[model samples]
Target: MNQESQKSVEYSQYYNLECRVADQVKAKQYNGALESLLNFITLVMHRQYPPGELIGSAKLDRLCEKIGLSFYHEFYGNIVHRDEFCSNDDVSVIICTGLFKSGGTSPLIGDIVRAQGRRKSTILATNSLGSMSGDDLAMSRLGEVNANIIICDKGNLVDRLHWLVQQITRLEPSRIILLNHHQDSVIIAAARPFTEKTKVLFYHHADHNLCLGVHLTGAIHVDIHNVGFCNCRDREQVADNFYVPMTINDLGSDFVRRVFLDKRRLTTCSSANPHKFSNFYFYPYHELIIDRLEARNGFHIHIGVMPESALQHMHHKMLERSIDPSRLVYIPWTPSLWKALIDNSVDLFIGSFPIGGARTAIEVMGAGVPMLMHENYLTRFHSSRDIAYPDHFLWQYPHEFTEVISNITFDDLQAHGMRSRDYYLKYHCTEKIGLEDELNRICDGTSTTRPAPLYPHHPDMLDRSLHFSYLEDMAIGHSIQHDRATHVAPVAAPLTPHQSVSLSLTQKTSKVIGLLTARTYRNALSLIPWLTKR
Candidate 1:
């Protein structure tokens, strides 16, 4: 090729070079369409099963090498550019940052949009990578068909609604959905109409007693779904759907699945802070378990934290509790995290209640590690514990945990790991969720993802609040009365009527005497000048 042709070939990155060919075909703007099509093809060409076992050895290695090259290879002659593994958009540029779905091959919403089209499923996520990816995955799919989307950022109220509305308008979606954690009252107060059809799913992640404020607010016009504990006696606490794990199919050959049957240690990872609540308060039950674990010698402990700040916080306590700092693994880096899990011989994983049903749990179980987690009766935000039911495979709180460990031998651990892995494969896998089916239904408008239940103002609300107040007051009153009775001395003798009258008179006299003493001191101070003059 001549220098001009070679130069023109490289310039194709910026300007469309196929214009001449399109002009020959008499098709206008075919180059642009072809570029879009090429982009779609490129998205597929580079797609591999995210770093988990779903992608076989060859593709997994290729993915690792590609990702490795991005980080190791220099850009602009010196700066290494790990972010070059795929094409990126500025708005969607967030896909490459933080503890996102970086570790494994979780699909992004953009990928799904390119892969499947539209989906109809409730996307839920915490502020973590797994959950964020889940949310983005949902949003991307929705963006594909221009369906409505809503978002909730539980504790941290980063106001993105304005930008979100702007995005929704750009996409021309059918509706929008939104939810918030503790700031529902503030959310409702600041509500605006971005579009004609918008819905909110209000939820709380912790302590539900504060939900009295939520329930009291008539402004909760949108659906309200509560998760976590409300009371102790609620046997019907957890929701059936909440505990359902996602099911994934091995995109890899069946031969790979058959070959890997070993038990692995896949600890669920998270920031130990438990949202805004401290680990001490949020995961009281987990603290209790840790205490028991420290009493033993053979048992090793691992705490998963991310962000140097979070890791530091986890470090002091785990050390104080005699847990090794080396065991304090930082955030799981997706496919590597998943790979580490399968490669390590972990027996049982433990979880804290302060956290929502974390994707780490899903990933760990996916790796075949049995889990132990707490199950509170209700949450401070949501009305029902059922709304926040954790994925199955967890031996819920108030468990026979020590007895379980004592009873289960190493062989038992191996067996349980297999069972756990199988459970994840059946339930938590993305492919098994029938994401394609759900997306089609959502796009076609065949399914209505049920809205959270709406609550109306009722007189009973006031009555219940009053009753709760009364109970609190009564308890306080009794405690004070009991303390006085136990610690204060009784009257030395029973009083006659005249003696009681005399005692009352004496009390009044004492008050008069105290007032008189105060007056006398004032007068004496004033007379000092007069006495000096005399």
Candidate 2:
């Protein structure tokens, strides 16, 4: 079919699905309609695969494994055992939440949809959390299900989508997916350079404001019957065109086989950031975990970070609340420190932010340590969630984490270590499929889930943006001063190396290091001569 005609047919099919879903929701036949929609997506739009030349056999295998685990881990809840993913009978679906890098609310809704998988259900890479962060909504959905996985694409632009599309071309697995209109535009932009025959199922997560966009662009719409678009105000007619996919209760044995493989260690991962909202901001949740664990005694928690220097700035109050310094292992792993930190034998890995947590959590999972994430939909999409082991993916809320940790028995921890190795075999072992899927999503515009801001945002709304802008100006000014300072370097470092070395030796040699021998004293005296310039 030609592009325009094809898009029309697809849009019609989607609208039909939407009508059915809306009818179901209205008639209270929610469960039946949702199952039908998932089955339809699996049978129809998802079946197409890229040619072997475009995606090699080896590449395909890698892709399937990547999607298998990527989708499974995000929604199903990370399992600690490798054996947990023994069966692959369930169809995994990725929900294209939205276009923006932040606020993937529809992706959060994917967890609710994924529970329907008989073998394994997954909501993949919908980063636009509807309106506000709504991370709790995603976690709440995940908390209720054991069969699905939420495969979020949150990482480098090239890598994340590449991993996803590579899997699509390779595995040719049954994938029931949705792409929000805004994100679909971005993905379409990326995919335009590639072949146009590539069939991607697009679902508009937000329909109200986007109805004009879709209508104007003459875009094909999928899931228009069942999916609801968030963040679109004042257009109830567009919204009325569809219904959100309803909750599903009975997943199949395949789901049990797919997600319940080997047990994984229980840990959450994050890094420290100065932003009060950053996961590293030392929120009450972290303190609550430590306090609960310490009250029970013998709690060993390992918090991993990128640079070890960051640990020095860790809030003492937060640490004191959790456990003694010894029980909490702070890992600052640069390329230089990874080996040493791993050698320390960490059991469970935990992190908050997706960017810093991605590599660290992957390394820990590869080592057979399970991961605990407080379940932020933002990081899960743009960064961390995809790389995690399928069964090893544990989704937690900040408040309920202590209770989750309390449930992990010592035996479970050991079981998780072994399964973690299995997770490595299945997912994190390669970078191929993960890269492809992410690229595909970007190309397909499934990743671009939100509209750009209409104007310059409020300063508070743009904290990171404003901070970086300020820093950029400071950097430019600093650069100018440094250039000027270079001409006067000789005058600035007036002390000869030999003399300074001798003074250092003198100070080191003296226990008291009296004023005469101290560098501070010498510098003060030296400053007197340059007082006019100072």
Candidate 3:
């Protein structure tokens, strides 16, 4: 068949499968619904590699628009523009974030900025805005705090930089805080003309190795975590940076009480991305620990927000190692993920190696769950060693992890969990951390001596910089290599003829049922004489 005809057939098949899934859901046949859903996903996966591309496509956006799936369209669509830029020169502070995703230190920083009672305008990068919505926790929190939010339009890097420059020039704020190094180059370029007017602050949330390309000389490097700040300060390039630890604003007294009061299971949870496990870096240690845990009764691992493909890879690895997959539970991404973690009675929270879980670690501790993390040189700048309570677990070697896991009893876990919660309250809580004071000091022209470059300058250092693009490429390459190493292909083969036919029949039946139901409703309405008279 021609391309057009093939696409038409594919659309028809997709629509039919969707109808079948809806019917199954309505009839409470969840298993059947799941099977149909999987078949639909398989079809989509075959058509689109990486899965993310499906959501990013214009065709999918158009289809969503035609189908009145506003939420889906908003979420999946590439371009996100929020033209809330206030021309008022009264705005003193401009808090700019590179990515729009709900995670990261941006939301926390935004919350702190708002709490400081300063006239501020927040700008979100276009790429980040695609993943956000009006109801998103970060957006809602910003709204509640009355921070003016501006989402940039999607464009090429140069176009985005020009737009950002235009916005910054227009706003003419006294202080500008760049959330991460992803947009440092743009922000630096934008503020170059207005360097004397606005003091730019670069908040380093990730490790220095991850952001080597970022030119820190132009901006005031502010490390939020103590150890992270120390690590950055020790570096010659970022030595003169300020230290302002993260403050958890949403943690209330009642929340703390609930955390301490709640009874939980011996289940362990990790919100780390499965891609972090793709390489043999930490997987061997993880496998060793998991095997030991599973050998004992009443122990389970609940992984959060792992992709289906990654989960499958992990399951296969477990099986290859003679481990049981039944003990491992995969939790998909959801808005109420914190509630889900608590409700599932996750007692112990685990952190990934090389790159530690910063936000997740704070959250798990705040929820009164003890966390254990493996620290290495790569994670020295962003590890749990500094933020976590002394009682909380941190291991450098595999044997250390095994020993910690083996000796810890239920009572010990509870004690450590409580300590972790207290540690969060004392150090990380917004009420305790004097973020406003530090922000005000910076805004008030409190100048600090600039530090020298830690590492010798290299001609090709910029290209080697572990920016998001570089990291993504590395992750993709690692995934491909890891898959090959395990003898797994990137994409699975097509379904059998029997499976396709069964799915098709389910769809056809569902369409018939839907038609019958619509017809019956129309007939009932036609039978009403009063309705006809009206």
Candidate 4:
């Protein structure tokens, strides 16, 4: 089939699924409908199925809200757990996530625990959390400080979910903060009925995607930055939406970095996991790096896991362009990504493309290295807009990125680095990232009467059909890779895809869109209304 025909098929598939979901709801089969909704989301997200003119977050959020309400209404008293447990007063907040030993929301979860004291917080690690980060990096211990909570990886999807629900029943925490993988229907299903006693907060870390937790009943969707707050708030969804200033808590280590520049060649560095460096950017991220390096006889230090194949591809591409591939050196996963950048005396740093890495960007900026994020969808996507907008490091087009980085000198680095540091201190510093007030308000059932200012979507924001073929090409087939649609998220430093070293080298894992396993497949069965699907 031609490109247009392909897109039409995807659109039709989604439309039929949407209708099926509605039928299920009308018939009051909420769990089956919820399962169907999840399938619809994955098809849209990874496969880029354009169901309409725009793939907006609110589309499925409204459905999720509807299904969640119906399910909670019918099944609140019938909730079950795998095990019965005694209550523990120590559990005040449950930090739930898929199996990510480091990076992603682990640090933020740690910050939440630190705020209330570690003893009052519990980390409920689900089976979907895969890809362990660096063993030595203290951030892997949820960012320099230590926080070991409960582990809930008992059984398959259903069993683990039941296990999670039972933990909540026993502990009865005052609040349950979700730093979950977005497409986790299990987390959504498990936590749906518990909102009466415990407040559920959807911390919008991965605000760009259509995840399961957006508009559930009794849940408050908290956007960490202004752009996210504006985008989601303008769209209609059932949940109570609010904005909170984003923050990160670390060990508060005092360290100073000095950029040791070798007068002739400019050394640039990027620390985002290689997955963030995909074709989704304006130009391929490797091409962007190569152009910047070739312009001034420069060198670049990359401080994350780069698959052997990607490394060879860059080598071949560099040789074809008549630039030495040696100019681009790939360093294995460094314990300290920002420190590696600073220690290498990098004159300039580039943020990960498409999905910008705000967590690491803040760290590098705080360390006083000049950095900029490649921007396309500003207000539409969850980015570091609270800081990178108006005056800071945002390059909108490829030509602009080339022009800026090509002419940058050490003096430029120092000046821009100083300005970037100023932005960091003014906005994201630890003292500034307090959620206590927001927490208290959430607990008290207080909400802002003010609505968010309307921000129009970027012209290039909606893809007619966004092709994500580059993802599977990299051979990232670890477990739970598709659980949150994480291959497309604002990724943490991907030490290795799903923490499997050799798997990153080979390309054998079946795509999440396979025949029997795909949610899209389940979507087809939901069309029957009373199919009683899992």
Best by TM-score: 4
The local distance difference test score of each candidate is 0.32, 0.35, 0.48, 0.56
Give candidate 2's total backbone clashes: 108
Clashing residue pairs in all predictions, respectively, total 37, 108, 7, 4
Q: Candidate 1 clash total?
A: 37
Candidate 2 lDDT tens digits, 311-343: 332346446554465544554322211233244
Ranking by TM-score: 4, 3, 1, 2
Cα-lDDT of candidate 3:
0.48
Which 10-residue span in candidate 1 carries the lowest summed lDDT?
Answer: 48-57
In order, what is each prediction's RMSD in angstroms? 27.6, 23.2, 19.3, 11.6
> Which is the winner by lDDT between candidate 1 and candidate 3?
3
Error of 1 at 179 (Å): 6.6
Output the number of the lDDT-best candidate. Answer: 4
- Tell me the spans in candidate 3 whose CA falls farther than 4 Å from its real position: 1-97, 126-143, 208-218, 237-239, 257-265, 279-289, 299-303, 316-326, 334-340, 377-379, 445-534
Kindly list the per-residue Cα lDDT of model 1 for residues 1-534, writing each as its tens digit.
Answer: 777766544454213423432342243222232223223222221221110111111222222222212222221214312232221121111111111323112333322333234323222222211135443342222223322223444332212322232343333223222232221212222222221223222222212222211222111122212222212113222221121122333333221112222333323333232221222121233344444444333333333323364347556766887776565444423333344544444455655443333444555666666555543322222111132223333333233444454455556556656665665565556666565464345434464434223222122233234323433444455556656988854332221221122222112211212223223323333433332232
Q: Which of the two, 2 or 3, has more lDDT?
A: 3
